[model samples]
Target chain A: MGDYVFNQRHLLGLADYSAADIRHVLEQTRTFREILERPVPKVPTLRDKTIVNLFYENSTRTRISFELAQRRMGADVVNFSAATSSTKKGESLKDTIRNIGSMKIDMVVVRHESPGAAHFLTKCVPAAIINAGDGAHEHPTQALLDMYSLLVHFGRIEGLRVSIIGDITHSRVVRSNIIGLTKLGAKVTVCGPKTMMPPFVEELGVRVTYDLDEALRDCDAAMALRIQMERQDGALFPSLREYHERFGIRMRHLEQYPDFVILHPGPINRGVELQSEVADHPRALILDQVTNGLAVRMAVLYLLSGGSRV
Target chain B: MPSRLLHADDFDRTIRRFAQQFTEPYDDLSPLAIIGMQTRGVYIAKRIRDRIREFRGVEVPLGVLDITFYRDDFRSLDKVPTAKITEIPFDLDGLDIILVDDVLYTGRTVRAAMEALMSFGRPHRLRFCCMVDRGHRELPISADFVGITVPTYTTERVQVRLAELDGEDGVVVTEGA
Candidate 1:
């Protein structure tokens, strides 16, 4: 296929995409990875295109990653944090986005506190919408990047056993990864406490487990999510020490599986989901995930939004 | 529908003569860098580099440039081509560059190639070279080195096939819409 018929105008969730779509994204990302290795990594593919990062929540990492990806394609970016925006003045999401759309912005990468915020803007504005992360709905780009990191390390994602550890109820990253990784033919097991696990989470097509060690038995990879302290009201579990004892991935826990790689989406809750020692471990693909996250975003943003209209 | 312009023998002889004309004025090709446009241009560049090495007894630095991102007609295409890697391992600043392409019709490919080449760094000098210069002047651009020149109408297409890619080395003229 010489031409890229990615076929989708917006990337809302992985569930909306087919298996071929995900593979196409990963294949195109390989070429972009080569570009990243060159002396001058910047490509003028999207020059003169303006993209607005409309974030309703505080996110230093994802916002910066999307901005860097846009700059690599020579596109201009405007960051709009909710703390400094008119949304704090009680303006509606549509009203603010409609105003932004009036200025001829090409695409809007949105991170909203409510689920379906991206789909909400698709009906209101003419600009292309990319769901950075919506409430606990889906973070398609984050999961796609995680898949990229796994594909790079393991050379294949299909037929591999992957265990997602910790805070499954509140992690949008886990939701997105389950849909993508499963569609790519991976066996996924999500492990968390009863309180942190969402109701009927198995309906999302993954095995449920309360025990992390049991899930890690023969799993090729384990992704450790941060225990979102702010998302949890008081205490989802009995105590932090107890959670660390039962659920946290420590050095002793990893000694059982010799070939498993542990991954964590950053701003880590150091001694909670993973110990500081495990975070710094060589087998952990955490840092590589962060690095590949940029390339994956570039691939998605380029394929979906970097069109002729730009 | 199909007309052979240059077969494998002519292709080899033409590139050999091109190497002579290229290295004649300059005693030192150490400062020269050659880059080919994507797909077919890349294959032709490798063949030319091989011939140059045979004559000069030294390897010339080469790179591959994909101009898919820089094309002006990106939106007008029937299908948007996949983005290929634009790999320039060495820096381009203060180095003379020879850009190779398969066929030249409207000169849009050369225009896009020049824009892509400068993205790495400003070359000291840059020149275009093509295998066939089929005449249909939509833009004021010409190749510094050309293998053959054919004057044709806008309704005809100039297709270049390489043995490494298409299992044969030849040029053809085909009817276009």
Candidate 2:
């Protein structure tokens, strides 16, 4: 109705946020920003709201950021570790969510190692489902923050050239960022090894590339995708060294374009997809991305809750 | 709510007067160095910057800071969170920083903004400017430049809307819960 609600039960994916919706979220983020700046920063925006952080995957930044965002907005936050939950005891994902929903949770922020785990949980609970990270599928909030970071840097998203490098097949950040960036009118290029890069990525209306140098050229921003070793077992690439040599972004590689800004969704492997020098460089917005993660998540919660209020 | 109203010209003149009071001492301050706290502060800062440029042909740099994570009351609230973007193209180190806002009620927002601003860099001087300074100082803070001083009770809320953001320009005082 209101260009799709950023509500209590939002499923985390770029598909969930339309261009207008994204704009609305970003615009609403401004108000949340102001609220955050108050000495007594907690807003009663979600006074009685309860958010269940059902993380099946281990994440330091994502979980903590979401927790902080919720607390900042005046919502009650509950952290559910899947390792100790019924899932470890062989209970179904649906039953777990159902049992939790019975507790009257207003929303669920889920991060699972399996693809579409958040989607699965959505079916089991009426609570607003937000995908933190579901396997290799989508991390919508990560993409939103990335887009927010980029928009803040560039002033506008329309007609900008963005290159996403690394494990396109396994990186959920890539999938979400590609969808979100393209939707906001930015031209995106996915570059990595042929094995790691997804097939028919052009179907998403993005240019596919095996050459990192070619992809890096003339690009306004280059986002290096993290190579999840746990996900790769001789299927994607021959060796990590080979991937680093050809596709990895190093200081030498960055010398080709002095104006390009670099981005990486963290837990970065020093020499795998990106060099430490490039990651730590002033042009790198990786750490800023981490700081922005909290704010953007707060924005998501605010807009979703505010929409529900209307 | 007594239906308080001020004409657009009066608002513009107040802004002009506030701008004069705020910028008078910093005649040599580069226009490219001002930063605004986010939301309404940004709108007020933009107006001051534009008016300064229009009158003196000196365009100043403006940026917005989002202090969501830096606030003290974060843990007492909701867990489903949203974040805003913090955009400052240039460094604020040793530069004059004029933190702008629409209404100064309890001074808590300014305090949080100051905390957030410190993370970027220490400024040469930090000043506070506000559209309305409603008397209810929860902290020992006073605006360097104020457009108006309206005595308000604790149950009253002040709302400011700009044409650039809210499709209109006006201020409203409502009864708070």
Candidate 3:
């Protein structure tokens, strides 16, 4: 048997990838790094393949990046906006995905607001599924991009201290990053307000703390999660000013560790979870994360499409 | 089919003969360049370049041409071929470029490689070099500098595994059923 079997059809969580599997994907990404520099900037690897993007959530970067990655790999890309789809007309999510699957899609990249929506669609459609983002459950592609960014910056994944701060309970990026970072041998810690922090998050093998200052000290890198304003109305925090005063990473909090790098899964609220100065710091890799997002997503799509079978 | 095996010493002797034949004073051409079709051919060109550099103080400019997309038998490969990196840090314009490969068989690969090379730039003169020139030419092409010529029947295969890639230097011939 091969060292790994890709029998699992959908990527719904970072927990799906083992250390070996993540390493394989990263190694494949290194090969694809060269492909991105070509004049034509595409490979005929997935020629004649069809990839459908089903996004129920509003997105500017993730949806577009996934579309571009699929098209660049020689796959036919179909964008399904849920706002105008049959789902808005009383058709069930299952029925809509089934109807699309009936048209012969090779893969489905889905982004939905409800948690586990991608997992549910995977059961409905037989096509290979990639979760772009599904509510506060998981955004695995973001985590993969973060991992790729970390690997590029540090040159190795093992033996590093990574702290994820702000809205741990509500940030799908945190859930995925915790799983991805820990699996790659990096120690992960989650810090946020007690109300915003999820109960038993430590059971997932990440250290949880309520003090941002304690977590940020002497860490290799820190990723600030965006506070979901939509969820703030339900008593997640008392006030925006209180949240920023306590949990928001600012220039002073960053001074606790001069060697640390800052990251944000953006559409970042400039003053909410992270300060503007900290987000734009010299060591901040927020933009690099966005640039690496394309390369990493391309790597994932290429590998999941059986590019490594050669 | 019982074919004669050329030992390592015999292989070295063949390369020496080709070097002597091609390195004559009359064959000294200006702006002599060597380009290898990547993967196996690149190593062969490096060896020839090293030998030439030893005899003369001037080192020839080396280039690597990848003809992966231009292959005629691409469909026969079970999966998409991994793209090999093509590194040609020197200009090929107006130079007498000698294309090198490990083995010359059907000549289709060479033809495809020549087409691919032309896309990069036009060369002043073009010549072919091969470590082993087996007797099978499906195209109207021949190698100018040959290390060894091996006579073989249709149902036979000659495999060359170089130390740089395969961890050993050797050649093997096997009968095809």
Candidate 4:
């Protein structure tokens, strides 16, 4: 069982992972989930381990959830937002990371606006690196947590259909989820406007369509992508209302398929891709996704820190 | 890997004997609880709990603890150590508890276990149980119920194997391990 471990120093992307590797994380996540429900949820497993949350981008849900996962596992966590750090004073990313490594950090949980920011730090420092999110490239932990919520509902990830809707072109979550879910034997289907949908997205082994009604039907799970208006380039959709009218998941869509597990990585636009009523639907695991995020991050941090192949 | 300490027959008697003396001071097992440290300690704790039920006719609450994060020598480990899960099903407030483990050496695991236990709640009393109390004391903590004591050299390692996990039940001494 020890060899059934996450034998890696850095979690850069799901492209390097196998189905077994993802399953190792899910197995460990089951343990953390049980631990979270206990009276004293905290464990001393990572007690002496020290980690730094080095986020180059702005995030609340990702940053705070990683911080809580680290602390709940009994590790000393230091939060380092790049905006308030020496980087604003003209220090290079390498210099800042080297200086942080000089303090003898064990691991770094990083989020950056630029892709490969975490991959760059793996060579600059001795500490393990966990990519919280890197621009539009990937968000592996989000994928793992989303997969975990699905595992809780479907009892397995293999042989299930999951549809992803909204701004797939700019979504790091969609990219990572595609890699991870497909590796674990789940079929992914994506739907959005032609401009919002990336070119040749079907080449990544998913069915792509522009029809929301077709996208919403006959799937085990549905993950509504948060329309990244802040990160959108060149007005992909005409307006938010038109986008909602075309791709927005309403109560009726879920009513048609009662067993469809609903998921959304939040800072959710209630009326955008998902209707406000459907967001509150019992099938929506949006809030459960948040709760499972802690367990999944805890599993990722624990496996990366202690169960290293090195 | 060649030396044997106790077999299934002697192991069973030693546990029952320890249960008798350990419960001699208490009238009722209702307020008593059994907690095992993670890995092998949990297996030992479960057995002791079963023996207590057979002897005293009471079902004691059982808990499992993993103290990997509370170890004093985490920095000293050559490689990163995997932290085990800590599961305490019932409240630890004001109950008499017996902490169980297979082998006792260095006293560090017990000390760490005590610190982890305190985070839950203060028990009315805390007691320790060990199947083999091999003497290599780094701390003053000692077991309250000892099934057997075997003294060995620093170069050797004492291994306790249980059928539940290790595919057999026996204790062994590995020379120069």
Q: Say which candidate scores most in TM-score.
A: 1
What TM-score number comes out for model 3?
0.81
Q: Which 10 successive residues of model 1 chain A have the least lDDT summed?
A: A301-310
Candidate 1, DockQ score (0 to 1): 0.43
Question: Candidate 2, residue A223: CA error in Å?
Answer: 0.7
lDDT of 4 by residue, B30-85 (tens): 77888998889899888877898898888889999877656776555544455566
Candidate 1 residue-wise lDDT, A1-310, digit = tens: 5553678778888988999889988887877777677666777776767899999988989999999999998888998999997877999998999898888888899999999999999988777789999999999999998999999999999999999989999989999999999999999999989899999989988999998889888899999998887788768899888999999998997787788998888888888889889999998898888888888888887777645443
Model 3, stretches more than 4 Å misplaced?
A: A1-9, A231-233, A307-310, B1-6, B10-39, B52-157, B165-167
lDDT per residue (tens digit) for residues B19-79 in model 1: 7776677788888888988888888888888888997897988899888777777455544
**DockQ, candidate 2, vs. native dimer:** 0.10
Lowest summed lDDT across 10 adjacent residues in model 3 chain B is found at: B74-83
Predicted candidate 2 versus true structure: per-residue lDDT over A71-95, tens digit per residue? 9867999999877777888987778
TM-score of chain A of 4: 0.96
For each candidate, report its DockQ versus the true two-chain complex.
0.43, 0.10, 0.22, 0.30
Write the residue-wise lDDT of candidate 3 on A1-310 in tens digits: 1445444445888878787767766765665565565544665556667889998988889998888888777789889997888878888788888888888887889998899898888678667789988888899989988888899999987988999988888888988888888888999988988988777888989888888888988688898888887756488778888888998888887676688898888888888888889888888899988878887887777656542221
Candidate 1 is graded, for docking, as acceptable
Q: Highest DockQ: give the candidate number.
A: 1
Cα error, candidate 1, residue A160 (Å)? 2.4
Candidate 4 wrong stretches, greater than 4 Å: A38-50, A73-77, A85-90, A306-310
In order, how many clashes per candidate?
A: 0, 28, 0, 2
